[model samples]
Target: MNVKPPSNAIPTTATAHAFEFSQVTSSAGEAWIDKNLGASQVATSSTDPASYGDLYQWDRPADEHQKRRTATITTLAVNTTPSHADFITATGPEGPYDWTIPNIGDVDDALHSAFFARTDGSGVCPTGFNVLTECN
Candidate 1:
């Protein structure tokens, strides 16, 4: 399956290096995805001499360094149906009818190598084949 990351979903160097990861699972046959955006709290007491401690302590003022952006992943099955010669002839030849976002984990795994690289859809979808369509 080919997965396309939402437009404007890339993270910057500072965000990527300090980011925490989370998983989002969509219900079968449903459209639209939900994930919490922003920096996650790191434990204050867990730090040792080797570390500088959590970025935001529980008792301290909440960290206001992160912004939230919601993104949705859509999936579509490739069509195997054939088109009419008249339709093809009248209009320019077209490719597949539609596509769905690839599984999130698949995209995530593909990005492991470039964990710190600044990027947009390049790291995730890599393939430039997103299209507009309806989903349930």
Candidate 2:
């Protein structure tokens, strides 16, 4: 699945670097996040970049959480039901925010396996890209 970009794809002033692409089946692609995303690894050691690009939680935006050294505020305990109070002081929007409850089949469950593309125009991703949804 390696693709060489067209000559025009590279900017005239920039040097093109060799990029590698690996072919993966649908099932293997679905399992990638659990096995590699957010997992601890030596960034400078002899390693493959495909094994580690970045890690992200379910529906949360790609913030500092991806970096191992970055500190994150844990608002709720795992598997606990979150209340309005839990998110009252959150920096973002108002209460009744979306969150996934652990182990229960309910709306806003972060663990719910589905495709969730952000449409709110929050700019969660680059201009031409959309957030990658969790694969069930």
Candidate 3:
């Protein structure tokens, strides 16, 4: 439970003033601070600050939702309505998908298929870390 920032991260003057890093170990672990990469719960209007970190729609990359990080929206649809039925006919191949449609059980529906995980390198985790998978 030693809390360390990612190696690629830089410490800014503001960050240095805001956070204190210590080598002293407690039962919980060593204390450190890092940039909030959308995983921090902060006070925002219309949301509960203490509840959870930012909530993301499925299949959307974490970059687009995080505050400190620049948003790179890769989804095909932005605000379009999704299909209630089995097939997602509107958004084409780019999707922030719901696993219910086109049949999650069907092997041909790659989006809903259990085998489908992002093959693309657009992962959400910090540098030097990987998104944990079922295999891990």
lDDT of each: 0.25, 0.32, 0.32
- How much is the lDDT of residue 24 in candidate 3? 26
- For each candidate, what TM-score against the reference? 0.19, 0.32, 0.29
What tens-digit string does per-residue lDDT give for candidate 1 at 30-92? 221122122253224444322222221111111321112222123232221122111111111
Off by over 4 Å in 1: 1-17, 29-35, 41-136
Query: Candidate 3: where is the Cα deviation over 4 Å?
Result: 1-37, 41-51, 63-121
lDDT tens digits, residue span 1-38, model 2? 01111222222121111212221224432211112333
The pairs that clash in candidate 1 are 3-101, 3-102, 75-100, 76-100
Ranking by TM-score: 2, 3, 1
What C-alpha lDDT does candidate 2 achieve relative to the native structure? 0.32
lDDT of 3 by residue, 2-94 (tens): 123333442332212122222222365422333222433333543555423343344434433433233433234432223221222234443
Candidate 3: 10-residue stretch with minimal lDDT: 80-89
Model 2, residue 53: distance off in Å is 2.8
TM-score of 2: 0.32
Model 1, residue 42: distance off in Å is 12
- Model 3 residue-pair collision total: 1
For model 2, what is the error of residue 136's alpha carbon versus the real structure, in angstroms, after optimal superposition? 13
